[model samples]
Target: MAEENKSCAFRTSIGGQALIEGILMRGPEQQAIVVRDQEGNLVEKVEALKFIRDRYPILGVPLIRGTVNFLDSMVNGVKALMYSADFYPDEEAAQPSKFEQWLDRKLSSKKLEGAIVTLSVILGVGLSVLLFMVLPTFITGGLLHFFPGFPMWGRNLVEGVLKILIFLLYLIFCSKQKDIYRVFQYHGAEHKTIFCYEAGLPLTVENVRIQPRHHPRCGTSFLFVVIFVSILLSSVVFGIWPITNVWLRTAAHLLLLPLVVGITYEFNRWVGRHVQDNKLAKVLTAPGLWMQNFTTNEPDDGMIEVAIRSLELVLPSEKGKDEW
Candidate 1:
């Protein structure tokens, strides 16, 4: 763990996701997914990279890139998960439901798959927004209803605290799930392997095993920053707008989400660039890193092997091409 804190040889723009008994790594030139089958054999798949920004340069701009990249990541992550899940079907392999059958009949196989992934992304983002943003607003509005004179500042404070509380509870619930526990272990392996790579250590299980599982640029940290930034941004916007209606306030939050996400993305980029040398940047990311305790666990050697191989497959051939 101590070695994980040392200044890295260099950071990489590469990132990864932990899937069902597997790891998905995305690099500059390609992406790789490696899953461990029930038979204990590793299955690997690789795909060439395609960037939406290549055709739509404006989407690559700092603020715009955040929302675009966020959606892109969600879509890709969901697809990777679905791929891994195929290797571990339910014991009974129940037949498709009526709705599924209807959809299969109505849409081509490709279209059906695409529709499912798109719907998954929408539901995932919608749930997050409702849980972290809308719920807090309504809860705060109700709590302060009796106190008509309650200051907006106080109201915002209550909402902010509630948001954090709800988020923590959600993470706690996920960590307690039996199936999710193993995924979290793979999450840890992904981080530790990345740490090893940044430190210029050999990508061996022994080396990754000793590294820290929490990472400053983790998706968990990115989500935390989004919440933190939204709290501050919402407080300012609501203070000026002073929308007393709970529904209106919720609408205002949804409207401002893009801006909040943009700002958070830029802030993370700045911190990622400076975290190695700047004490302030490290301090800023401390909360997110601490939250990893609920989202990651010590992975076994086998998990580390999978993570290492997955990362290696996605690394660019040209030296330094993937450097952060």
Candidate 2:
């Protein structure tokens, strides 16, 4: 039954992330993030967004779409994260100043949120720069004293390996927390629920439980692909740099991230759509699925219910007329 359902594609094409204590669902037209608060009631926020492609058709093109989508997702993901964090009354969130609130009273909700969105994007970019640029450069620069005169390729290989290792180590560390584990379980639930829908099965807890949590198009899989793509792209770019300074090479890697992410996003899309029928897709994506074992645990029905409710809110009204 599961195998047969896998052949069908008409379901929902939306995707989401399990945030701090909530679920965020992103659809074609609008996105919603739903969180269960301390009062045990669901708090939901919906935002309507226009895709860059809709605004500028050229951005929807192959290579361009990947880059645009990556940035768009990052921006939206942060907003969803902020909304999800609001569920905890004790959570320390940045509140608008009195002056800003006064302005918000006069301005529209859209204007107020637009300011928040801009700030969030700035913070996200700053965080990425610190992690991917500064940290790697510092670590790799320190390594050079012990292994001097290595070729440029060798140094780049070290940096790439360290970056992947650091990323994995961070995941491992975070997965140890009890709250994070529960979030990971919900992450698993999200994947299984989507699988059930795509398989043309009723989106019930029982059916979703039987489906695998590892999805080909998952963020986990995408991250793994990005790491490898970074290694390849960074090596090619780094080859031009002299072997003298690790900081220079690391800086180059950071600068090339958009291209690397763009390529990986396109590759992931291709593999995800073809995985069910193509043997090679399965092979390439196997590591990602395996890695998901560390990231996703079996979720209970309550968690699945939360996922379902979150998904239902974001699905398009005309969803069933054609294949997703």
Candidate 3:
């Protein structure tokens, strides 16, 4: 088994999300969540993954898949987060609202859980838009009113910069929170374990411990790439048409977001496949890797164990099937 593991050299498509006290790993065929419960016991749940592309083949096409995958990831991520939080509930959390109470009384437990997960995903996406999309455009619009002579291209540049700044600030603020710090540690563990696997090493805590906590394929990196691509694309679009109206510019941005995400996803995929030894790839991924310093921290051995367990449960049965 060890020798077989050592023979693989390619990166896997398998990826993970760090949870409150757990790690969630998704492979081609299965998804697993492994959490360390309040009593220090490892708890794991695994389910066969049913890809949307399987049912709707059109959705699997390259550019289209990126948007679909993004939304699917959001839903899965929110659900995983909710599951992890259940194992470590806050004693001081507010009591359920009357509407929440009514829902609880009317629905079965499983249905209620599903509703909560759906709402959480929607809210998460809404928050992301308000922060990274709507906020920066509005801020730039306000600035344009103050300086009516601001260049159209310059407006795009300012909005892009503002988006990146807001993103960085958000990550920095979250990293400082007590609970989020622990989650970041688990994030580090997830990356390290994935690195160890790609290196064809035995998935022991010690092996994972010494690996780098940054990975080229991280969603954080994808997000940075999205921001970068958006800036470039928006500048080009606005430069060609030269729109001065802020609301119109904002509307244009919303329309262009799917294209931005698709292009960024393709770029990230290229970087991930070449990053091992390609200097150009390394340079391309540098910003995201640097950002990992704020979003990921070294995990303790116990956390490493959770990450490894989560990963092991989702490993492809056929060698190289998960190749990137």
Candidate 4:
């Protein structure tokens, strides 16, 4: 834990996502994806990032930027994942369905990539809503019907607990998969490399290996924070309005999700900006840090190399430009 308190001169706004056999790092001005190809060579793709806020100033506002950035990250992440997967396709993987084949033939490569990314983002958001928002409300509402004596607060509590349990179970199941475990290992590598960079250490496998795999600014922590904020917000809303209809309650939760995400993102940013030894920040971030155990795994030296290369490619040209 003492090592966790190691300080550096600056905190960075750079963040990343784990891809199939690769790591995607996004700095303030650029993004890079580095994957280890089957031929045992590192492949890197780097591009300048154009922020939507540059053209649309309104989206740059604090709470509003959170939602915008979250969506942007999702789109970029899906694209990078697709790119990384292309390098190591499984020969035995299932063939595309007739409809998929038809779409592939009808759409050009660029169009197909855009269409796939759009659909992926929609499906991903829908599934999140179904599992975390709708399912919990449905389950808790069913319990309330069967047990009329169940109090309103109890219903909220049950729903919140159910949401968290479902998330944890999902993470556990994903972590157990052979392919996903490798991705989680890359996730750890991404974190460790970022930690090493933040600590003002040289980007080397040995240095990264000793750094903490769990980062306060991780997307995993952002997700856990979202769940927590949703739980609290839902409880307060249900308490005030006392809605009993399950579907209506689910709709309300869905409507509140954007706000929950915004608040959680801001909280994460605040925690990220604080020194690691700050007691209040540590207490606030503890739960998310604890949850990282399922989302990150120790990485091999090869994985660390990929992470290092990715980070190096995306580092801002000017020092302190990425300061939190």
By lDDT, the best candidate is 1
**What TM-score does prediction 4 earn?**
0.96
**TM-score for each of the candidates:** 0.98, 0.84, 0.94, 0.96
Which tens-of-lDDT digit does each residue in 1-324 have in candidate 2? 247545765545588888876788887777888777777677777877577788799988887788789778877887777677666645443676799779788979887777878788878767765665567767887877787776777777777787777778767877888878988988988888888878767878888888878777788888888888888877776676564565566567677877888899889878867777778988999888777877888888877877777777777767563233
Stretches off by above 4 angstroms in model 2 are 1-12, 44-47, 91-116, 240-243, 319-324
Per-residue lDDT of 1-324 in model 1, one digit per residue for the tens? 365556675888889999999999999999999999999999999999899999999999989999999999999999999999999998776688899889989999889889989999999999999999999989989989999999889998999999999999999999999999999999999999999998888999988888998898999999999999999999999899888789999999999899888999899888877788889998999999999999999999999999999999998999899887
What's the lDDT for candidate 2?
A: 0.76
Candidate 3 per-residue lDDT over residues 96-128, each given as its tens digit = 779988998999999998888888887877788
The 10-residue segment with the lowest total lDDT in model 2:
85-94
Residue 239 accuracy (lDDT) in model 1: 90
Which order, best to worst by lDDT? 1, 4, 3, 2
Which regions of candidate 3 fall more than 4 Å away from where they truly are?
A: 1-8
Q: What is each predicted model's overall lDDT from 0 to 1?
A: 0.92, 0.76, 0.88, 0.89
- Candidate 4 structure quality by residue, lDDT tens digits, 166-199: 9989888888898798999999999999888888
Error of 1 at 258 (Å): 0.9
Clash number for every model? 0, 0, 0, 0
